[model samples]
Structure formats: C-alpha cells, structure tokens
Target chain A: MEQSFDDDEGVRWMLAWKAGDEAAFDRLVERYSPQVYALLTRFLGPRDNREDLVQEVFLRLLRNRDRYEPSARFSTFLYRIVFNLAVNHTQRVIQRAEGSLHGRHGDEDGEQLAELADDRASAPFESLEQDDVVRAVRSAIASLPENQRMALILAKYEELPYAEIAGVLGSSEKAVKSLIHRARETLRERLAPFLKEELA
Target chain B: MNLECAAFRRELQHSLENHAERSGAPLRDLLWHRHLHGCLDCRELLSAEEALEALLSSLPNPKLPPGLAQRVLARLSRPAGAQAELDALLELDRPESARPGLAGRVLAHLAEERALARRNPQPVRDLDVLLELARPVEIPVGLAERVKNRTRASTGTRGVLLRWRWMAAAALLALLLGVYAYYPRNPQPSPMVAMQDQPDPALLENLLLLEEWELLQGGDLEVLLSTLPAEDEYLLDLGAEGATEQGGQPKKG
Candidate 1:
C-alpha cells in the first residue's frame, strides 16, 4: 500500500503555491528537478531536448496546479505526470526516429534497424573485460524488457517500493514483483561475468 | 534446491522491499552468512547482488543543463517564453487540449476575458423563485427522461442491469473517494462545478486499479499483468537512458 502524504513537504509547499506563494513552487522545482531530470534522462535517453522535457514536466504541474488537491502525495502525482509524459513522448520520438531513418535509408531497411538501435546506443560490449562492471551493468539494464527495466529502476535506484512501482507502472504488486524478478534474472545472466567474482 | 537454500531465498526477498540493502548493508544476518557456506549458486547470487548494489551507487548522474530550474521558472514567469516553448510541445498529440498558446495564451485570454467582463457588466434581473412559477427550462439532454424510463422499466433482468449500473456507479464513486477524499474546504462544490464535472484523470488511472482488484477477486493479477506488453519490442528500440550519463544511451520510458 502507498503511504499517506497529507503532510508531505512537497504537498505542503504545493498547497502554499496554490495559496499564491510562487516561491513555494520554486522550492518544489529546486528540490524535485534532480530526480525528475534523472528519470527523464533514463526514460528519454540523453537528448538535447531533455531540459525542455524537464521543463514540460513542471509546466504540466503548473498547468494542472489547480487539479492538485492535497489528497495524494505530491511526488506520486508528479511521477504520474512524468511517467505518462515519458511514455507518450518516447512513443512519439521513437516513431519519429524510425520514420526519419526509414526516409533516409529508403533502400537498406536492415541498416536502418541497426542505426535506430544506436539512437541512444550503449558502449560496445565486445570489450567487456576492459569495461567496468558499471558499464556492463548499464548496458545489461538498457537491454532489459521494458516492464522489467522500469520496475527495477524504480525499485533499485529511485528507492520506491514494489507496491508504489506497481502503482506507477499500472500493474499489481505481484506483477511488479514478477517484473523485478525477471529483471534481476536478466541482469544476473547479462552481468554474470562481472557478477561472478565477489567484490573486494 | 534444498530447504536451507529456500529459507535463504526467503530472507533475501525483503532485500528489494527495503532500501537499506541498496545503501550497502553489512552481512550481519547470521542466516545469510550460514546458508552461503553450503550452496554454490546461492553464494554466486549473493555476490552478484552485492556487486549490483555497488555498481548502482557508482553509476554516473546525467549532467544537467546549466540552470535547469531557473529555465523552467523563467518560462513559468514569462508568458512569451512559455508560449514559444509550449507551441513546440503541442506537436506531440498530448491528450490535453494544450494548443499552441496553452500556457501564455490561456493566461492572456483569461486576462482579456477579465478585462472584457469588467467593461461590460450584463444587467442582472433576479428571477422570482419564491413565486414557484414554471419557466421553460430546457431538459438537460434527456437525462431526466432516461432516469424516468429506467425507473419505469426496472423489472427482471432490467432491474439486474440497473443494479449492476449502480454497482459500477458506486465503484466509480469509491474510486473518486480514494483519490479525492472529503474535500475539506468545499466539501460540496457549487452546482456550476457539479454541472461541469469532468472525468478525473486520477479516476482514469485508478480504473486500472479497480480492474485489477475486480479480476483478482478470484484470480491472479499477475496473470493479467502478464498480458500487458512486457516490452513493446518496437518501442524498446528507443532504449532506456535512465542509468547512463550524457550523450549516448537507448531511450524508452
């Protein structure tokens, strides 16, 4: 179950922002933008327009500010906004990326797929021995099935519990656990070489 | 494979549920220390888990553009800046009717409307309601007729269907209650608000919740979740950059 946020810092600040304290909203922007930036970077890949996307997230918050009553956690509401934005944005971007590629390489469909793969490419895994465990792990995570990848990232990095991850991902807790389990399994297999030896 | 291994895995389950494990918790659990002695794969799993945690902590953060918060706040304050940016964002077929000038444009229009309203105040002729005089009130899109027909036609399966409709209404009401519990300030909004009630975005979100809850009443949600595309293979082409630093990575939400 999700925790209550009736008195959460973000909620209080947002309520104050609703009460005409523009500085309160600024406090929220300062405090939460890093996390938002990180998630957008993760979800959208490293693109030039990322800061714009981050701005869009807050812009969405600003636009929908009145809709936000103090009922739910401000972070949860913000996350829902970002997650939906990212999904829709990713869908649009990838479609555009593919369309541009298809247009450019009208003849060579095979090469188009390969170049698209590298739109947000991982470093070559050919030299895993030289690559640090972190690089190996990032590539492995980048390669995961979408559901598993999101569940793991939210669970492991963002410090959200399985239930909240489920809430964010529109899945039940069991499904979230299944997703994480599948993610861990894949990570274990992919990073097996790096994971084999115990840490010093 | 053995009982101790199963037990070791049981103790390990809480690792994901808690954050302390990610911050690099020491191997203090005697059960963890004890079980690893007998199992090879379990020991490997333990090593992998620890290594993953370490790598995660050491992962680089994406470099932020100079003054990101400032940029966003500037846009918030400056309607002109926001208008140009929002026009670009409008390219994405976002569900909201965020047309080109959504932010600055809306504000400008509202300001204009305010000015207009002040300039032209319509004379108010208060209707005599206490006279109980019937005015030609337009029926609200046949809702009263539909309710009248439904009440008149409630019989057998029709009554059951009506009951199901009420149940769905109650379910929707409960979902609303869950998202927006007692509105403390204005528990009941004005009739104007009630007239303009639109579907809650949160209500749409919790539909998934209510669906899962209903399905799981006698079945597993995992089974249902299994059907949700684990990966849109076409979309996974976008790749995830959540973990990577600037410049290169796959993008997927």
Candidate 2:
C-alpha cells in the first residue's frame, strides 16, 4: 500500500505556522521534501545539480508558502514548482552551451554516473538489465519534444491526472492526452528491439 | 490483422487506460476477448501495453537527504518573529470599524478579546458574558494578534475613553428598553405621517414618481410601492406659466 500523507496535515501545519508555531513549519517540510526531491530527480535526470535544484525548489516553496492554498492537491502544487524549476535549469544549460564556442569539456560523465548510482538506489531496479532498460528509457524520453517529454514524465512517472497535466502544460486535456499518446508511440517504436528481447 | 481488427484493438487499449472497468460493457468485452483469443499480434500488443504501465507504476519513491528538514525548519523559525511584525503592519492597514470577511472578522474579534485578557491578566467574573457580548468570530489564523496590537497602538489614550463611551451607550440602550416595556402601545400612525417621519423628502418624492424615473433608477420599485394606487392623468396645466389651453377651458385660479 502507498504511504499517503494526509493533505489536512500540511494545511494544519500552515495554520499552526501562521499562529507562530515554528515546529509545525519544519514538520511540513520534512513531510514533503522527499516527494519533491524524487519528482525533481525524475524530471531533471540523475545529475550533480539535482540536490542543488531540490534545495532551490524548497527555497522557492519557503518564499511563497503564504500563497499556498488547499485548492489543488499539495503534491500537484509542489510538482508544478519542481517542473518549472527543472525546465528553467535545462533552458539555462542549453543557453550556456550555445553561447560558449568551446563546449565545457567538464567531467560531466563521471559525475552523472555517480548521481545515477544515487538515483538508482532510491528507484530500485530488479536487476542490472532493468537498470540498463531504465537508462535506455530515459534517453528515449530526453529525445522527445519538450512538451511531449513533459507530458510523458508527468503522466507516466508522476502519475498526475490528465487534468492536472493539462494545467501544468497550459494545454487542454484533449491536447495533453494526444501528447501522451504520441509520446508512448514514440517510446514503443524507439524501444521496440529492447522490449522484443525482454519479451523473448 | 485486418485494418478493422487493428483499429478495434487500439480502441480497446485506449479504453483500458481511460475507463474504470471493462467487465459489463458487452460489445467492448466481446471484442476484447475475441481479439485476444484469435489474434496473436493484438495479444502481444496488449501485453506490451500492460507491462509498460506496470513498469511506469513501479518507479520507487525517493527520500530527502539527511538534515534537509532541519534546514527548512530553521528558515521557517526565523520568519515567525518577522511575521508578527508584518501582522502588526497589516493590522494598521485594515479599517478600524469595518467588518473583515469571515476569517478577518474572526481574527479581529479574537484580537480584541486577547487584548482585554492581557490588560487584566486576572480572572474576571462573567468573562464568558463579555465573550458572548463580543461574539468571537472565526478568523484566518494569525490575523487576530496583529489586529489587536495595531488597534491598541492607534487608539492610544483614547482606548479607555472609547470603552467608557461604549458602557454609556449600553446603559442608555438599557434605559430605553425598560421605558419601552412599560409604555402603552400607541396606534400605528397614518401612512402619510409615517412617510413624512422618514427624513428624506427627495426619497419620498422619488418613491411617488414611478414609470420613466423608476426605469432609469432600476430595481423592484413597483413591488416596493405597490400599496400606492395609480392615479388617472392629472392635469399638466401650463396655466402657471400663463399659457392658454388650446381646448378653450378657463384656466383654474
């Protein structure tokens, strides 16, 4: 069974925090930080910057906590923040690469492998074969168009409802469904060989 | 598979994700079962889709790094005192006599009570009576103390004088009520006199003049003034301005 945190608990923490109870605010962060971190890692991929991005996401939450209402689910609200931050970070990296004549011939590969190990520890695989499959899936996911990738990540990984995915993507639910359908078809085509082997 | 059979298989796969249960939908279930039995190609496709869904669902939940909670708590703790200061500022911003919406109104009432309690710090007899009189309303959390502090600051020395004035007003109200209880009931005044007793003549005249005027001023005036009977066309005598009638009737003096 999934260990679900009561939404009311976060609301209560907010109420208590508003009432000048500091401990309640701490408890609120403790309750949600892991989920937020997991979501960020899923979106941004296993990288050294994941922890820093996670911190930034929480810092953003702290800065804007007063604005949080119980309208959307807390996870939805949190995921939206993580999604935007990850997208912005990706855009920045792209921009940096475009500006520089010499690509930052940094040790990104080594760092990425270490981060991958850490990420895999949290997202346990049945075997090394499964890990390779996951890595291949991640690469295929990255190759998708940005909107399609975001839709796929939110739907397949985050398990957000179609409506919430629409909200995050600023598209209609019908459009979001089409994007996911297209994305899934692309993944199926791309991973056909691996999947066929697995089935065999 | 035939194009028709492939399309049917695709629809079944889509419905499996979108719909809650496929059990009782006769045509759909029959199509699905038939496709699975007769078509190896469709069967493999369906199995692949299910496996993909299961794999997606099986992604593990990650945990936050050590001490992350402590860091968040530390940041949140610093904000408390700052929030109190901001609360005071916000209280100063709000109107004094105006009732805030549900949350704001409740907080204001609580703030007033908290102030009173702070001033005495001693147990007062019939504190519950005072509380009932005050009518503590539910406020948005964290607003009351802010409102109270600001109210206290702004009122200054006049706070005590305002309390005395309130007591005096209460006493006068009680006196009026006692006199009203013992006094004999007078007969209801005539409608004209009651209308006259209303302070504004412009309001009364506006009430009487219906139709074009009422249409411009909107609302259910017909319902409001339904008791007044409609009069037949009154003379629009131009005699006051010394004009003669074309019909040759003598002008009334």
Candidate 3:
C-alpha cells in the first residue's frame, strides 16, 4: 500500500519525532524510504553507489533534522535533501579518480530497441509494440538534463504540485514549469516515432 | 502553425493538467475546441503527454531492501536515549503561549493556600481579597473622609499622619517604577528567544540550533564545504583570502 501523510499530519509526526518519539521516526523512515529509493534509482540509475547514496540521504535527514521548518510540506524538505545529495553524489562519481572503471551507462540509443525486444521475449506483437513505447518513453526521460529530469520526475511520478516542486528545486515555479515543458518537448522529439504510431 | 495554435499548444499541457474537464467560459472553450479541431500537432502533443503520463504512472514501485530501517538505526552510533533526550529538548525549545491556562491554575492554587492559611491563622494576606477590595467602583461622596475619621477614632491618629503615610507610599511606588523602567536588563536574549518570527518559528530556531550544535565541527565542515556548488566554493575561497590569486583563480608559488 502506498502510504502517504498530508503536510499537517507529517509535521505532527516530525514534531513527535523531534520530541524523541522513536515510533514517529520509524513511521517517517518507513513512509519515505521506498519513494526515496525509487527516486535515487531512477535518477542515479542502477549503480553500486545508489544504496549508499540513499543511506546518506537518510543520514543527512537525521543530521539536519533540526534544520527542518514545518513551513512547507515535509516532503518538499525531504526531496530537497534528496536532490542535493543525489547531485553531489553524481558529481563525486563523475570526478572519481577511478571513474574510467565506472563508465557511463544508458547512453546507447542503438541498443534500446534490442533491450526492449529482450524485455518482451514471450509477449505478443501488440505487447512488444507497447513495451517498445514504454522503453522509448523511459529512454527519453533518462536522457534529460539533471534539472529537467528531476523536475519531470517530481512532477510526473511524485505528482508534487508546481509550488512544492519549486521548493524542492530551489527555483521559481515559472522556472520549474519551463523546465518541465522543455523536458516534455525533448521527450516528444525523442519518442516521436512511438508517439506517432501510438496516436495513429 | 499559426501564432494562436502555437499559443494553444504551449499551454495545452498546463491546461489539461489543471482542467481535465475542459472547464472554461463558453467563448474560451469554443476557441480551445476550434484550436484542437484545426491543429493536429496540438492534439498529438496532448495525446503523447497523456500516454507518457499513463505509462509513467504504471511503473512498478521498487522493492526496498529488507531490514532497511534496522540497518539505518544500527548506523547511528549514539545511544537512542541520549539522542531522544536531546531531541526532546530541541522540541521543547520553541515559542509557546505566555500564559497558557495559567490564570485558572494559579487561582486554584491560591484558593488552596488561603484555606490552609485560614486553618492555621497565618498572616499571609490573600491577594484575591486584596484585589476585590481595591477594584474601582463608585462610592459615597465622603467615603475617604469617612475612612480617615474611622481610622483616627480607632487608632487616635491625626490627618497629618495619614497624609504623610500616603505621600511616602506614593513616593515609594514612583521610585520602584523608575527603577523598573530605567534599569539595564539582560542585553542578550536566549538563542531561541532571539529567532522568533511569524510563520516559521522553527526555521530560525533550527538555523540557530544548527549553529549552536556545531554541525560543521570536525571534518564534517570539509565534507560540507566540498559539497558547495562551484560558485559558492569560489566565494568561500575569495572571502577567506585562501586563494593564491585574485578572482578565485590559483597562482603558482
């Protein structure tokens, strides 16, 4: 079950946690870990560092728990921490001295069709086509710039309102909207064949 | 595409996200309908966005690692009780009502005290009775004069003595008022008291608490400084005069 707390209830739990209610802390951890894990996986891709980064995110959450103000939704605060940690981790991985070993993954557009075919091994032709469409969409999303990718992820997957997404991004709502719009335009361009076929 | 169609396409996603029912005024809705009928690109864009949204919404939730929370809790080296105590103090370190339900409780306590005083014949004056007696109200024309006469008859004191006593009480009160109004109070407010604002009391409180807690202590500062974006790192370097050259660029020694 996808459990989520509204901002007020979340703040109450946060207050209780701050007041040393271990159960409240457990509730928060249980409630958000899956979502944070999913976000880290999607943003960082499947990497060895992803789990470590997720742990760092929670650790920072605990370390910086005092810095949280109930002014905005707790989710926004949590996501901002996630975004900063993910960005930092990405930068560090990029600059790692042994970076040559951890070469870039997910850059092969040529192999995308093959991957989709493999994913749909036993499926019918229609399912294969649908799977291809899904892969095409995911591929387009995975290829967006970091800021645009995150904005799209928060907007599309988390369904965060633009205002809250703006909070998470530390950008204005207009900027976030533009980011998503440009992201969608890029996705449309990348997936144009699948989109045209699907629409037809 | 015409400018109108372009404008419609640009706003189509926003509108669809907000107004799924296509709710608008008649003329506006007509324009939207006309635009959709005429502009194939807009229709396709809308369809594609919706299809992608559907696909994204259907993506399966990832399975979390088993025993994740226990793993996290185990990473916390500090004892839970100590952390809990500190957290409790932090929680209590907030602004609260000045006199939350205090008046009633004080009154009840005072009543109990008065009952005890009555049983023991103690000299403790009940403030409630004093307040009732001192409360302002209309009185007979010569009420003060009657009081003075009664006091003089009972204690055989002159009006001059009563006047001097009244003058002394007034002077004492004025002196006390002057002292209270002019004396230098504590110049510094507590950190928590220093950071009170309307909406987010916790924001400033947490900022000060973080500073006081020494979040950047030990090598954590280095880790944090390393995480600063390039621009911030540059500014930090420039401000600290740690940069060997001007404009945050390095100079070879």
Candidate 4:
C-alpha cells in the first residue's frame, strides 16, 4: 500500500473503517506504526523491552480506535498516547523498586543495585559514541524534575512548537520557554566538558 | 568590565538561545561591536557557545534496527477470527437509515390519533372496584378465557360513561372559563380621572383669600392695640364703665 503524506490520511482511514472498509484500517496501521514505534523507542530506549512496549502501545490503539478523534493532528494524538503509557510504565517500575526496598528493611545498598539495573536496562545505546552521548544526555534529562524533563522532551525530541508543548504539559508558552531554558542550563552544565571539546 | 554592564552579557546568552539569528546584521557583527566596546570574556564565551550549538545540531540521528517496522506491524495484525468478530459487532451497531419514510408515516398517524383523543375529551370512571378486585385476585387457569367475555360486556357501558363524563367535564370547564372571562372587575382609574379629582381653581382661590383675611385682621388688631396712647387706655376704661351703666353696650364712634 502506498503511504500518503496528506495529513488527513489518518482521518480518512478512520472514516473508512467506520464505514466498514478493512483495507483502510490496514493502511492506517501501516502509516502510524512506525511513528508510534519511533516514539516508544525514544522513550524506553534500546535495553528496556522495546518490543513489549511497542506491542502494548498498538494493542491500546486497537482498543481505543473508537476514541481516535480527528480534531488534533494524528501524530499529536498518537504520541500523546505513547507518552502517557511510557510514563505510566516508568512510574510503575519506580514504585516496584521502592516496594522491594521497603520490604528488605531499609537496605541503603539497594540504591546502587537499582541504578545498575537502570544502567543495564538502558545499555543498548552505549555501542555508538554519539549514541552514548545522546544516552548520557537522556540520562541527564531523566534526572531532571518531571515537569522540566517533560517540557524538554516535547520541545526537543518531538519538535513541537512551544504552544503545543504548553498544551501537552498543561502550561503556558512563557512557562514552557522558562522550563526549556532551565533544562538547557542544566544540560550545558552537565555537558560542559564534552561541549568544550566539541567547541575546540 | 563593571558588574552592571557585565550583567547584560548573561541576558545576551539567554537571548542568543531564544533568538538564534540577529534580526538585521550578521550575529558576528553584533557580537564584535559589543566586544569592541568592552567585555572581552563575554565575547569569547558567546563565540564558544555558538560553536557548540552548531556542532550539536550537525550530529546525525541514529538509525534503528531494520526489523522495527515489521515487528510493529506484526503485533498490530489481529487474528482472522477476532477481526471477523469485531467486524460483526461493528456491523450490528452501524447506524440504520432504512424505512425512515414508513416509520415517519406511522408516527404521524399515531400522533394524529393521540391529538384527536385529547380534543374529544374522555370521562373518568370509578375503577376503584376493578382495582380492588385486581389486587386480591389470584390468576386461575381459566382467567384468560373469562377476560374476553368481561371486556365485551363492559365495552358499551364504558363507552357511554366515558363520553358523558367527558362532556360534563368540558361543560363545567367552559362555564368556569366563561365566568372568569365576563365577570365584573373593578375599574382602574386612568391619569385623566386623577386630573379631574384635583381641587378646582375657584375653590383654591377662595381658600387663599380666607387665609389672607384672617392674617390681616390678626395683624391690624395687634397694631391698633399696641399703638393706643396711655390716656386713650384710661378713656377706654371709662367707656367700659359707662357702657355697663348704659345697658353694657359701647356705642361705635
């Protein structure tokens, strides 16, 4: 099937599916799968189970196909779903780790093990040097407070306009700009040695 | 550089990130102009920051494994049986547009019947006995068979009573409505009636004249009494005694 770039293809496919055409649904899956996969991979990275997460995203898409309204840009709607699920999964993992630690009677040493688990789970990007740098940057990003990290991710990776970023994060454009500025300041500080070499 | 002027360089860093390109001149020109004026450290720092931004932007995005798309597609493809079930369910819920004309005609007929029934009116029968019987009656095996006979027997009486009661109710309502419509009501006064109720000009002038006469009499009496000389008072006393002797009436001068 030939993919369309008309931007309304998602809406067209949805309407056609509602009208009982199966082929249009197939086309929809083909068109949006890669975009959804790309976003999930960015969120989960290489080492964390990408396939399960991607499959989970698509399964949710199937379950929620009826709710897919065409008012927003399809990519925005799709990525919003992916982002929410990924954040939820991350939160669950964090909660599980906390539970384990609490059950073990205040083992401070478990903190290192948890960090190691995180490092190992996020290890696939370590192969390429640039990937390694991006990973480092991502880790630094993940270390940021949730609001700032969300603001940065939507602005940088999603290439969303400040207004759109504001909409996603439930903030104003000025606040979004402030968040990105603060994020960049933090990133610059962390990557100063690397940045200095790059500049040289 | 003075700290006050150096503070602008901090703002310049933020501005450079937010506004990457200078509006008119090349960024280098703007930077060099600022540099020439003062603040060598900031000039160097700005240049370094710009160089780093360029390098970061030039880095290529990493390509994913080739199987990524295939893997995603494979996961999304539902099994044939599941797909068929979903299709069937969707079909069941699909909005039906057939027979609208026939349905509309039937609805119109029912609505017309209802309107006619309302206009002709209906009687209220005493169903209390029937209701009491219904409440206590146990359904026997032969009850259904007796229902048809009972219905036929009651139909004539029901019809006559319903019609008579309807007519009586309508007549009573009409009488009440007529009384409400034609009964005498208190007449509200208009602006013209209020104008007519006001005092007449002749009456108002007479009242004013009476008030002025009383005031004049009071004032004149006070002035005459006040201006009388002491000898005149004694003469008045003598006149009083003389008047008493002469049948108690003073003669007018």
**What are the per-residue Cα lDDT tens digits for candidate 4 across A1-200?**
55443567777786666455657756766777666665655554444355555555555555455445565555655666677776766665565566666675344236534543553243323423564655555555556655676676665555677766676666788898889878777767766656666667
Off by over 4 Å in 2: A1-24, A101-131, B1-31, B54-64, B75-253
For model 3, residues B172-220, the per-residue Cα lDDT tens digits are: 9999999999988878666655433222445435534654565634344
Candidate 4 has an lDDT of: 0.56
Task: Spell out the clash pairs found in candidate 2.
Answer: B103-B140, B106-B137, B107-B139
The global Cα lDDT (0 to 1) of model 2 is 0.58
Off by over 4 Å in 3: A1-7, A47-49, A97-135, B1-11, B16-35, B54-58, B77-253
Candidate 1 docks with a DockQ of: 0.22
Question: Which candidate gets the maximum DockQ versus the true structure?
Answer: 1
lDDT of 3 by residue, A79-120 (tens): 998988777655544443233336634433224334333322
Error of 2 at A146 (Å): 3.3
TM-score, candidate number 3: 0.48
Segments of candidate 1 deviating more than 4 angstroms: A1-4, A105-124, A127-133, A197-200, B21-23, B79-105, B108-253
Judge candidate 1 against the unseen true structure and give its global Cα lDDT, from 0 to 1.
Answer: 0.62
For model 4, give the TM-score of chain B: 0.26
Clashing pairs in 4: none
Tens-place lDDT per residue, model 1, A1-200, is: 76567678999898887665668988999889888988877654555666756766776676566656755567767877778777665555466567766665434344435433533345425438676665566667666765676777777778887767777777899998888888787776766666555355
Residue B23 error for model 3, in Å?
11
lDDT minimum window of 10 residues, candidate 2 chain A: A119-128
Question: Order the candidates by lDDT, highest first — what do you get?
Answer: 1, 3, 2, 4
